[model samples]
Target: MDSMASAPGKAILFGEHAVVYDKPAIALAINKRATITIKESHKDYTSIKSDNIGLEAIISPETGLKLKKGEIGILNYILKALEFYHDSKPIKIKLEIEIPIGAGLGSSAAVTVATIAALDKYHKRKTTLPSIAKRAHKVELEVQGAASPLDTSISTHGGLIYLNEEKKIDQIKGDLKDSLVIGYTQSEDTAKMVKLVKERMERHPTIINHIMDAIAHTTKKAKKALETNDKECLGELMNINQGLLDAIGVNTRSLSDMIYTSREAGALGSKITGAGGGGSIIAYSPNRTRKIIETLKRKGYNAMKADPSKKGVIIEH
Candidate 1:
């Protein structure tokens, strides 16, 4: 039997580093997704292949997972998910990832969620979505050392999600898909970026705490703007949120250039989407998406129009 599952990537619109401090955040599920297909193998060991990251590995209960030097981190996510299952039965795993790896777009979370969901189907476990999400979060935490449930939650549930300081999740209903634009420069280490912010906070707790509070407030206002379909207000809130992220020391020179270029091209608001050392940025360009994308492309960036996916992880057997 063959079991396949896919989950959407995410873009954090409101909070990134602040969310780690238990502040509110707003994230949306992007159409890009990571898919995993599992099948029983005749051999005595599990084989993994991922074309997106140029990875191929073979693992057994005894030999364990071994990778080449400088292998991408998705393999770690796969290994952790496999460990959760403990199904040593020889299997072949194929990963097809559309989200750029390490671009702060929840690529790791997406792949981990899809892998677990597919494994569940393959083993006839019939795991529920919530269980899969929880399990995926564990896998991420094990691999990344530190993580927030925001990415896994959004990838599992899809659409728009609001994560409050209390860790409560509220699904926001809105269709700002047409107004969303994403631009990618390069990938960054999420863990490193998170650590950098932590160091800064340790050095200046009061200042960073105030910044976190401001981000929480901005996130709440952005939620309202989405609920009422106030594009202008939401755009302004995004700019404010970006300033807070900058204050936290996640912004980069390339990211800032892309953001300002987008704004100059008529984006209502633009900011780094996640971790932000050198990842991607999101621009709120309601009617000027084309112009913003063109401008970013001319300035040398991989730009695209993105939509918030309503569907989450699903079996495709």
Candidate 2:
């Protein structure tokens, strides 16, 4: 028997750092997706293996992740959620996935959403997107420590979303038809970058005020543009956003170079897509989508054009 479920990857089109401080952020689920496939095996316990990240043993559903030799990645949200409701059975589950990791595009969150959704469906359990989102958010918090709940929200509930400061999620149901160019810089360790920001937040509180203030300004302006249905204005606000992120000390040489070069290629707006210190850049192009992609690739950047995927999780059995 084969069971499958999938979730979309996401990018923060509007807010990032400011969201941590009582500010709203806009996010969208991109076409990139993570898939979890669980099939029966002859083994006694559940096991997980990824096409890209290789193999690992599934942890016991009773206790969370174990510290054994082959248990490094056993805490997948699918297994954890199964354990959460004491629904763990001694059935062998094989895992297969295709979401690109560490691209700052909500890859892990998408994986969690997809995995948990699959598990719930497999057991014939009822769970809504919001409920699964909260569960996935908790798992991410376990990993990132200080992670906001935005990624999990969008990954589970797809389409463009306007997330409030209180983590209340609402879908932005308007015509979000803007063409987006996503580029992967693949520089800087994501975890190390998070640690740096955390360290600065702990050591130097004064400097963060100006940075957060600037992010708030851009985020607010972007939200207003969205409200007005002005795609061009939204693109312009995205450019301002990159500047603010640079001020916040998260922008790195790779990220900065890509953002600047993307602008020179006539992109209407450009910013680092995720936790920038080298992740990916999301650029909006008002005129020529192919030209924008071609320009980035000519400059040795891996770029692709993508649209917001409206559907959240798709499951099949």
Q: lDDT tens digits, residues 1-317, model 2? A: 46678889898897776676666788988887888877665654566665456656555556644433333432445455555643555555545554456678887788888877877777777888888888888877676566778888899888888877677887764455657888886645455666776677778788876677777777767777877778888888898888877766788787777788888888888998888877798888755667878888998888777788998888876
Task: For each candidate in the order shown, give its overall lDDT on alpha carbons.
Answer: 0.88, 0.74
List model 1 lDDT by residue over 202-226, tens digit each: 9999999999999999988999998
lDDT of candidate 1?
Answer: 0.88
The candidate that wins on TM-score is 1
Backbone clashes under 3 angstroms, per model: 0, 0
For every candidate in turn, the CA RMSD to the true structure comes to 1.4, 3.2
